[model samples]
Target: MSVSPFRIALIVDGEYISAWQYLMLERLLASPHAVLVVVIFRQSVATTLSQRLNAVLLKVLHALDGRFFSCKPTAQTPTSFLPLLGDVGCYAHGSKRYQTFVSTQRVDVAIELTGQAVLPEMVASTTHGVWRHFYGNPVHWWDDYTNIREYARRQDEIVSGVVRYMAGQAAADCVFYATTSTDKVSINRGVERTLWKMADFIPQRLHELATVGEALFQRNMRERVLARPLSSQDAVAPGLITTCRIALRYPSNFLRKLYKFLFRQEQWILLTTSHGNVTELGLLENFHKWIPPRDRFWADPFVVEQAGEQYIFFEELIYARGIGHLACVRLQPDGSHTEPVKILEKPYHLSYPFVFKHQGQYYLIPETAGNHTVEVYRCEEFPHRWVFEKNLMESVEAYDATLQEYDGRWWMFVSMRSHQSCSPNEALYLFHADDPLSTQWQAHPQNPVVASAAQARPAGRMFTDAEQLYRPSQNCAGVYGRGLNLNRITQLDQECYREEVVSSYLPDGDFDMNGMHTLGIGRGLSVSDAVYIHRRLGRLDHWIGKLSGFIDQLVWKHCYVLMVLPLTFLWLDM
Candidate 1:
């Protein structure tokens, strides 16, 4: 294929990072292309972790640009105005400076990989294409066929306001967008019906995928119904086969609740550390080795126990990338173990894989969090050849779903991030399954049981020590991971569940105060136990941090004084 070595200007938002962005950057720089990046950092220098992370990102970006293809990254200072013009703090003055620089910088294409909404006027002057690194489908508050249309309308209004800001500016020649599943209609429909009417919708090399969406929607319909609780259907309710057929035909809305009723259960006293500080709370004694060094990022871990062996499934994040694998190791009866073995690795990130054995068959359910789908895999030779069977849930902006079987019914609790805001405070959805491993999932009418970000994220599997079920949620009260606040699950079916923080671990003055790995429960040959692991940046990160500090000092002494000192005082007087 005859291709052009495009000159691309990428405006990146530092808030969200995904594998897609990393992969796209690799493609752009690997080819015979030129890229100028204007990175908008959302960090204020006041916070410790934020400053350190931003510094590391700066160093990494600098190294990448110097070593890789023709790439230049210019850090843009955020725009700061007196807090009241009703201006959503999207772009800054330094961003304006970079934009003006790009206008004359011979850049053919400008791609905004940050999921933030940008106006066409921002790149109307560029000759090459303008693409928005859109993630997920444009979700509306209301559930209706016209949802896409409404989303399109809002986008047009927002973009038009931005266009008016750039008077007489010509629109982009072609616009690029990343599509989402189910919302493919809404996204494309809105784009073609609205954005296209404004500018030509250009097709790009990277296409949107729908594998997870299609799989989840198809299989989950059957799985959800089987999971629903059987109530007093009373006089002449729908038959089981007919109800299953209808459920399979018309799946429940992912946002809707499937069941209601709460059951009080025991407490899961999990102990962990954060930011290098080690702290263990609750009945979580003899579980201190699980905490990792600070400077590493870890997520909630899932645990599984089968055949007298305990295993912990966790997300190993190295440098912010998800290491999707079912990390397994023997959890000795004495709460001691060997190093973890890389059990299973999915093509995409594999995390929170809830494993269980049913009638000599080992079934694994992994949360393909970013893929927007969940899948079940059967072990061909027990933890070796795991063939993909079906998806349990799909086409929803959800994460960290944990499945539980209670009162002869299987229920799944998940935190749904609203597509409208991509915020984590949205309600939690509960799904009931006739069979725990089946594809039929029914939604609870009261859907979102819990909607608070502070308690929404699940730490791991909801296990039953005796005959009761308990939910483990991340108690991010102080610093994000200072400690986990344990809660007793009081209800499950009626959706009237409440948690009282019986005990929690607090930071004990260590590097762990800033970061912590997730906590998990596992069982081994000798005894059943819990396992925890986290990633910590090597000492090299600290040295680099020190170096960056030195560089900042030098810049403050030389460049800062030379530029800002003279200009600032003069401008202040003016």
Candidate 2:
């Protein structure tokens, strides 16, 4: 049955919008269920001298700072978003033209794109009320400048998007929430990346609201993932003294960067437990370590046991090649290991070798996100040969495809990104099918079941013990792959999904440890991976140091990029 598309109206200040905001409009226009019926240009407002100066300063800093990380807010052009703005004209909120147009076109939804505060009258006019975004702390102003505050606090940013419905005249609904970490190196990339990802959810939610009526759409509602709405005590911008104090730390950071470039090396190694469940991983004494050579990193491990022999499969990425491939190593009885053998290699990069035995046949779903595919492989010969199976999902930026058979169906948990500009480590998507090898998969009603990077990326396989289901995930808060989050699934189905973290495991600072992410348990053994900031000079580090020296010489000779490039860690974005 063909249904009428829901009428969508955009509230904007002329044609000015962020590049990510333009992306949201294009996505909405592309959705079959949403029609951009009108674009109401907001009433013009004057900018104060201080506001103008602040804007210029922000632009100059961003342009200079973007060289370190090639991410900056895009300058706008009319032709870029003009086509998507249907029937555009300037109008006040309560103008006669606005009312007549809304009544005639039957505008179903209103989206605020002007960075304005949500008004009570906006909901009273539109049928489905207004949709707006708040990109900062949960309980802050609409357009809070949070990068400085978050950098100063060393905390993750909770980026939120909400829909204000006219239900008895109240505006408190955080419909979309993603609390993700900023970039470890550049906060500009971190902030921009988090905001760009919303291009996926804003339109997807509209489709759901139009396809399924409001009653069924909100039925079996998932848990609210945001903190309280904006409170009056929250300051929109940080204090000047506080920002100045934060900026003074850059000198120490610059010194530390030199030391790190010359002496530090980050390495990932595999760890195996003698006998421990997924929930309780036990102490360091229970683990046997497998350290790879300094040239390669072995991660995303999976295990298989056969006839008193154990085979460990993982992704091995050489530092020189900068690409990952599937490899396997045999575990010896005396807690030693044989050299790893190349298992599978393709033109594109691969990782997260999710192997399983279904219908007496061995299958593996390695992360082929490089090819934009969630591919399954069947083993023609054990531990050596693998042939192509079917593509479970195509044209998706999905990572760590983990499958579990539960409640008479097969559920797949995968982290996904909307596009290249967005980060995939913050959202967890769910899909289900009748059989493990089913060709068609059904997406959950609430697509992004979990939207926090702290535990969104799957770390290992899901397991059941004592009639309880547990899923392990990577803790990418402030840094990627920093720890393990052990979560218990309270509910799961097509309509709704929920999970709660029960425990956490972080590196104990032994051997200069920094992080642990992947985990797998089978046949009385639990295997995991840990990363350490080892103090050793490798071939790669040597070249980086050499390059740093060259850049330093150029920076010293010319004062052009001195304040911006040489003192790279500045007040612009920490």
Task: Report RMSD (Å) for each prediction in the order shown.
Answer: 22.2, 6.7
Q: Please write out the lDDT profile of model 1 over residues 150-170, one tens digit for every residue.
A: 232222111110011122534
- Residue 361, model 1, lDDT: 84
Give the Cα-based TM-score of candidate 1 against the true structure: 0.42
Model 1 residue 227 CA deviation (Å) reads 28
| TM-score of model number 2 | 0.86
Q: For candidate 2, give the lDDT.
A: 0.72
Quantify all predictions' global Cα lDDT against the true fold: 0.42, 0.72
TM-score of each: 0.42, 0.86
Q: Model 2, 209-236: lDDT tens per residue?
A: 6655776555522345422233233444
